[model samples]
Target: MTRKDNSVARLYRLAQSARSGQWNLEHDIDWSRRPRLPFWMRRAQARKALSQLYHGEMATSDLCEALLADATEDRYEVRSCLGLQLQDERRHAAAYQRYLEALGGIDPLDDGLQRALTAARHGPFGNLGAMLAYHVVIEGELLRLHGVLAQFVPCPLLRDINRLVGHDEARHVAFGKIYLPEAVQALSDDERRALYAWLEGLWQDAADSALNRRRANLAIATFFRRWLGGGWTRHAKALDSLGLPSATGREQAA
Candidate 1:
């Protein structure tokens, strides 16, 4: 066979192996029995709400497929990384499914998750780079927020679930680091400018989501009350740690 044929074969094999590794969602999670609830019912509810967000992984995978199909010829690595990300998201969704099943077979399909996905799909930065930035930068910020929430939850089972989801998120951030800069480098000056503008808009959206007053207030009054005793001050500190601005400040900057 020709050398070019060999190269294609190798790449195809690598892609197959990577995809196969991420296929079994049930095998990865230890769903031996139902998890016990925490002392704070609100904290339990928050966990349930967060788990619902994972239900949108199918939508995310479809988006990723679209992005990958549009990837330039020289971006094979980026495509491979996106494939891995797709697998990880599927696994994450499965893990969350198990957690939800444990919680009285609840399926979390709330307006919040739907709104977030819709906003992302319709964002000013509608290209691959914008999607990458949102996943890496924006989702990375959300994972940090999840970490804070996990700390506040008294239930060991819920904390374990958060940690598992966080692990997958970290992998996604790594993939973003791999592709985002390369994507930036490939763009024209105008495209770069548009991307930067998109980044700014996405950053504002993330800040608003993080410091969502109603959500924050509900979190504090319920599950996160122990950690956020100082109220908005503590919450602001958490947002700062994640490199996010307060919602009010983000609006002002806009």
Candidate 2:
């Protein structure tokens, strides 16, 4: 396998960056601040969004656990970066849970997120697949959504939470961007195709979730399409760069 010795520095820097950026969910967040739900976003919608966000953060922690459990000593830098990500995910989940409590407690996990988590846990990709599914696909989508919420949501606390959490998530996605190409290059063509197939299934399961299909004002809906399309395009390019199968049919199907 080809290893980029230079990436060791980058990975170490990422871990340090995460450590420096860590904040106390209890003290850092302005818990007393309340959400100002816009007319476009109903109270129910806001609650649902937070609930889903909480669950998403928790699922990411689970993915980190899966990755770390299978992590080997040889990949010290990679594991170190992922270890910090596990910390970030746990903090993010707790922050969201606290936010939900202020907003009248957590709502049920969205069906789409639940299904996506289930598929991720049972998927055939093993460790490499786990990284691709969560770090690459899911985190990319989530980062975009977080940006949108930060911009549109009027709540001071939600905005603050999104900013901090998004910072950590961007790093997670960066880890995938830098690592996946090099790691995937060692795979056989058949293996690459299998990876793409697994990605396609996971993407479909997530895209069809209720969170993505939520009804909203036309302007917000349009914004979602634009942001989500950009995310998909970027993810598709990453796959292409990795020599994975074309996602054309899957894109059209979505």
Candidate 3:
């Protein structure tokens, strides 16, 4: 097939997968299968989860806007990927919002959420390569962390939500893997170096949220243990090979 044909085929496949995944989550997944949490813990866990998710939505919105602001016609593939990512992020945020409402309404504009938004807005813009690195490398780490969380969260509702979110994230990571190399290859050596530095800085920012938080009531500790065991390290290596510095390297640079 021609390159144009391949691109069309890939786009179709991604769209189809996204549609199927959406249908499955909405229809096939037994949302009712999970028992309700006890009143107190339900409120607590929901608050915590919803707060984190709201902050994530704010951050992704900032990133998406930043990407769109810099995008050109030549960057069609990257724009397409970012568009899909933005959609997924919005959907995930809506899902969390629904859960929060079901548990009891949550305050959407918390200080934590505002701070996350501010952080994303103020983040450095190190050209197209650096943007790809942030999406493909740093966000990929978050996807892996969520996968681990899906396995161990005690509440069935949360487990189901995390599992569904993980599936969507896997597709985002795949899209990144497919496109990031091309973006990196297009950059000059000096641009690549700047991109790497920007990525390392983002990695430090991500590590605090992805690895450091201590949620006393949830399975966060168990998830962290599994993440640290080998999984996260492997992910770090994969990201490193994709042009970002490894987690250890990021720490050293810091």
Candidate 4:
């Protein structure tokens, strides 16, 4: 088998292994324990941010389903990995929804995240761009966000959720990293440029939304800014590695 074939085989193995690694929401998280929300986190602004995150999980699930629908049988390993991720995303959305209910009912999805969801659902790009946008960019940022939440949130239940979800997200991102390089080699210049444009807009929308959220809540401004910086750096590196145009430098300025 070629190196690309080996990578796909490995991804399939990882997906199969993920079956046993999965945690049950009802059993794994100790719901009996009391959840202590920090004073600042209890505000409406914080709740809104959490609501956006919850909605993101739902959006990810939807995107996974879309990706799976378009997947062909030729790429068995890749399709299997995506199928596993689809299940993971659904469970993540359910977990986040329950967590939101414990804090307060879910809020309306933020405009930025809502825009992202729309793009993921109805983007003009082909399969490669969709995977790059959803798996590499969105899920990559989400992996970092899960770490941030796990570390910052005092509640054990929330920490557990982040830990478990982060593990699955890491696998999803891994699939993109392994698969995209080969797929990108097949793209025409025009297709690459189109994808870069689409992803640029997606990145900007998310940054603008995050900035708006930060400005609205003074208490978490530092956290938001730091998160944005990390996300920009991650995007820059991913773009460079993928041989795509690096627009994150411009995003950093904005």
RMSD of each: 7.8, 4.4, 5.5, 3.9
Order by TM-score, highest first: 4, 2, 3, 1
Off by over 4 Å in 1: 1-24, 69-75, 105-113, 154-164, 188-190, 206-254
How far is 195's C-alpha from truth in model 2 (Å)? 1.2
Q: Residue-wise lDDT of candidate 2 within 126-178, one digit each (tens)?
A: 67777777776776666766766776687777888888887788788777767
- Score candidate 2 by lDDT: 0.75
Tens digit of per-residue lDDT, candidate 3, span 199-245: 55554555545455555635866655565456445655666666555
As for lDDT, the candidate ahead, 1 or 4, is: 4
Model 3 error, position 69 (Å): 6.1
Q: What is the clash count of model 1?
A: 0
Question: Which number leads on lDDT?
Answer: 2
Give the clash count for each candidate.
Answer: 0, 0, 0, 0
TM-score of each: 0.64, 0.83, 0.66, 0.85
True-vs-predicted CA distance for residue 242, candidate 2, Å: 5.0
The per-residue C-alpha lDDT of model 3 at residue 206 equals: 50
Q: Mind giving the per-residue lDDT tens digits that candidate 4 earns over 166-198?
A: 788778767777778778768776676677778
Query: Which ten residues in a row are the worst by lDDT in model 4?
Result: 245-254
lDDT against the true structure, per candidate, is 0.56, 0.75, 0.59, 0.74
Superposition-based RMSD of candidate 3 using all C-alpha atoms, in angstroms:
5.5
- Measured with C-alpha atoms, the lDDT of residue 44 in candidate 1 is 54
